[model samples]
Target: HGSNIEGMLEAVELADGNPLHLAHINAYCRGTVLPEAEETELALKALAANPNISCESYLSPLNGTSAEIIDGLPGSMVTRRCLKTGGFTEDEAGMEAALLSGWAQVNYPQGQEMTLLTGEAARDYWRGQQTLVSVSFAVNPVGPRVRLATAKKADGSFAVDAVSTDGGGIPRNVLLAAGLALVDLGGLSLQELVAKISYQPARLLGLANKGSLTAGRDADITIVDRLQHSAFATIIGGQVCYMDGKVLGRGGRIITTAAGADYVRSQGLEPLVVDLADSSLLQKAQKR
Candidate 1:
């Protein structure tokens, strides 16, 4: 969530070893203000030294976050930093002006995509729909993204951790396609790509049975055409929930840990406990 790896590491140290999932880390790995490649190398080195932390990066170049102004200030720290780094005004008035000038993009929830907003139109939109808007920053670079995607551990598992979309309804669902692209480009093997997208994330969430094709596991699967590099089918628990752009049925069920066992059972769902130590994040940290 932070751009400065040093700052993030300090925060982790201050937290006294709490498990942390650093989100969309590649967004922070490259930038204009800081030394670019050095930042990512330092971040990865720090990560290797501390296994208590894990991170995931989206494949896309644009980073998205809420555009809320907190007490006349930017809502997202990254947005603030990006604004300043890009030589734009970093204050509230500057942000408003930037939006109206079509320099910054606004993601309207109803519109479902990023678009330029400006002038009275921008102010009117913010006044009427502030709560329903997010801003996009073109801060992510491809070099760090590819390096992070392909980084591996001693056992050949991903070092940067998981493949994140940071995309659900916002529609940046390119994890599988982009990962496969990486594979095709020789940046990573197919198995490593799968681990980054599935196994590693499942391990992080402590969902031991959800990431792989092993017997007796959850049949959650995403069937993608290797040639097309796209997903045409998605199955959950042996049920074809989605295929060919059509929803078959609402087949999802709640999945939780032992700590939430009472709630899971109360909701008529089964509890699944995966040892936190089973995660490669912690496993690698222990080795350190």
Candidate 2:
């Protein structure tokens, strides 16, 4: 919700003790108020002091948003922010220029996997799709991403709650490959790495049965290639959903809070209800 470290801190103060979850904390620390790492430090400090707020960030340099243009400007606020950050106008003409110059990357369909397209091909794909595709821009820098993923508070608790892809609904999924890189670099231990990507997040969401490999816990697992640092297989609820480049699971149930169940059903999705009463936010509030 905040644009920079100063605004984010001000926003947290403005909430007046309400529970908050800051999504993609690294994306906002673009060296506006200070250097990127300095801004990140300020954010971590604020988060460490406040138990009411929880947050997550990713390692991808690319940020995802809608490619559509309505009237003259981009339709999504996030896309406009990215274009402005890249020194481009918020209008369709600027978007076209951005695509032509390879700054705006369109998610194009290849064989089985989605890949990035730039320059003329990207521009044409966007136009051909009637400007209704997802686009990405290299807006996130490196320093803040690294710091947020592994920073700890005075009590040794994680400053940020999880490592998330932001699910920009594009190809920004880099949690495993990138997080393993941190492990290899000694930024995190294998156990701590599992917690950030799994355990901590599961606790935040109140998924009591998921996250760990302990006895009586759900067997949701992601097998990874230690050398390549990519995912090899995925098991959900003790069911092997994916393995060896084949998708065995048919569809996914939507993970939603009580308030969102009606909408999930409206979208023809089966809802896997999770209670916010058990969520980390309310628990943190109780501690406070």
Candidate 3:
């Protein structure tokens, strides 16, 4: 992430033309960082000036943060920042108040899925969990979010390289739903949306086998219901992993560094070795 406009600029300077993929770019433009509009503008300008810096942003307004309070204060710097953003104290009492007021929502488990809970029940659930749970706040500003996602570079490439779901923890994995809405309104072409969400992301991760429908590409695919604007099914490595809101596949390969391979095997999972030298980021560094 570009944590903020300055953070993004600093990282770019530090990279010095090496490839840098910034995730959740919208998180940095929430008015807390140099006013939302200026932050968005600077972020886009930086991306355009530096093709070495790739970027992604989510569509959700609610952002994930730690609910854990330590020694009377929020444990995470992000949590403290969020509390201040909502005009609350940077303490435990403020978190409780935020939850009670619905400015904060607890991400609690409901059946096998995670759902957002606000109001009294949310505060209760959070207390029951000893404030160790994760919570989300509606902190992302709309204008910056939109601009960051749709900006174009000088060479006609996407300023923000992808639309990523910084979800799982916050449950705002609405990539297709939100992205397709942009396509429907002609803010983005279908191909552009796919390239942002799929093609470029694959490059960021160095997933050479995925991201395309070309003849020999891996059969990793997601079928979306355009009318409903939701994921219908997912196929990974030619196997059905998810269908009809159910996870069908038991296990998936863990892509990790060589040092993590032993731990992954100990957990009875296969690890796909990732050499840092081969990463696109480091490859650029090598060329430089």
Give the local distance difference test score of model 2. Answer: 0.85
For candidate 1, write residues 57-79 as lDDT tens digits: 77877677666787878877877
User: How accurate locally, in lDDT, is each candidate?
Assistant: 0.73, 0.85, 0.82
lDDT string for model 3 (160-232, tens) is 8788876755578777888898889888998988998898777667776667888887898999888988889
Tell me the TM-score of model 2: 0.91
TM-score of each: 0.81, 0.91, 0.92
Off by over 4 Å in 3: 276-278
TM-score rank, highest first? Answer: 3, 2, 1
Q: Which structure is stronger by lDDT: 1 or 2?
A: 2
Total backbone collisions, model 2: 0
What ranking of all candidate models by lDDT puts the best one first? 2, 3, 1
Best by lDDT: 2
Cα lDDT tens digits, model 2, 51-88, are: 78888889898988899999878998878877787788
lDDT of 3 at 222: 94
Which parts of model 1 are misplaced by more than 4 Å? Answer: 12-20, 101-103, 111-124, 153-157, 258-288
Clash count list over all predictions = 2, 0, 0
What local lDDT does model 1 show for residue 25? 72
